[model samples]
Target: MSPRKKIVQAAFEKKKLNGVVARVGLVLDISGSMRNLYLNGTVQEVVERILAVASKFDDNQTLDVWIYDNEFSRLPSVKENGIENYVAKQILNNETLHKFGRNNEPLVMEDVIRKYTKEEPSTQPAFIVFINDGGVVKPTKKVIVESSTLPIFWQFVGIGNSDFELLRKLDEMEGRFVDNANFFHLDDISAISDENLYDHLLHEFPEWLQAVKSKGLVL
Candidate 1:
């Protein structure tokens, strides 16, 4: 096994998620402010790391990908074999989708909900990793609250120095059928070790799985 995949598998074992089966998706912030991260290869690294998690968690070993700014594009799904230069090939070089613009969380978020709940419904749960540098809006709360009962778990990661107030307060958000999201902040994702990063990424997921299973959110 690849080293990163081994690290992710170890993380799953540590979290007692050894037998869990789920779909994995990645949402990247392509807003104007994120230009540096993308250009510096940070976004590509993020894709590779998340793809490792998908290698272990997803039955098909594929990672569904989406990039969003004011608008969103559902790019082709990523498999471990094709992870080389994924961000550059799929997003930067691909002229078909919107590039860096302003942030609009609700639009892309709603589409993610539609994909998992309507287009390709599944008995297995979906674990979505949402990466944003900042500028999350209030409208996003409505989408998260409304999608609370669905078989999707949102793991929001704030990368950069932004306040991320709304993301930071996801746990305290009200009126959800269940707590469907978790948030963590990192000044620089690449600075973290693989083991530590996987630990943080999977931290709240097991609890969310237990809660959702008891509520029949996942079959």
Candidate 2:
């Protein structure tokens, strides 16, 4: 098996996310600053790793992929095999990061809220893997506070050497009804071990499950 596939399988066997999260959303950042990461295949690798993680959560073994810079667009649902090609096409497409403009992390969360509450509500708790490499600036604090009662968790992963000020703030942010977000720093994510990666990736999830259940966020 490929190293990526092995990581995925190992996560399923050791982590045992089965019956935990009912859905997985892999949110990718396509800002200009993120261009290198996407081009260098770091983002694709992360997608593959997350796809592996998602497989353990959802029965369909697929992930709802969303890309954003200042704006958000939901691409097609992707499985492990198609991740590389799917990302390649997006990166090599006419709409380059320069055209996409700023990196608005809040817009992605806004889309997530609209999708779940109005567009399609699911009682099953969702695990959102939000990837970015810089600071956030979208008044996401209010969004997280409002969505605190909803059945979803945001696991923010920071890539590259950029200063993730907003992510750090979010990690330490308070006043929410429940703790629904966690952050992980991956300066060079490609070099990280799958075991260590998965460990931190899923560290706070069980507590989130208990918290959400106590609040009746998921059924």
TM-score for all predictions? 0.98, 0.88
Per-model C-alpha lDDT, please?
0.92, 0.78
Model 2 worst lDDT run, 10 consecutive residues: 91-100
For candidate 2, report its TM-score. 0.88
Provide the clashing-pair count of each candidate structure: 0, 0
**Candidate 2's error at 169, in angstroms?**
3.4
On residues 57-142, what C-alpha lDDT tens digit does candidate 1 reach at each position?
99899999999999999999999779898888888898888978889999988888899989999989999999999849889999
lDDT digits (tens) for residues 133-165 of candidate 2 = 776775867777788888888888888888877
Give the winner by TM-score.
Answer: 1
Residue 165 of model 1 has an lDDT of: 91
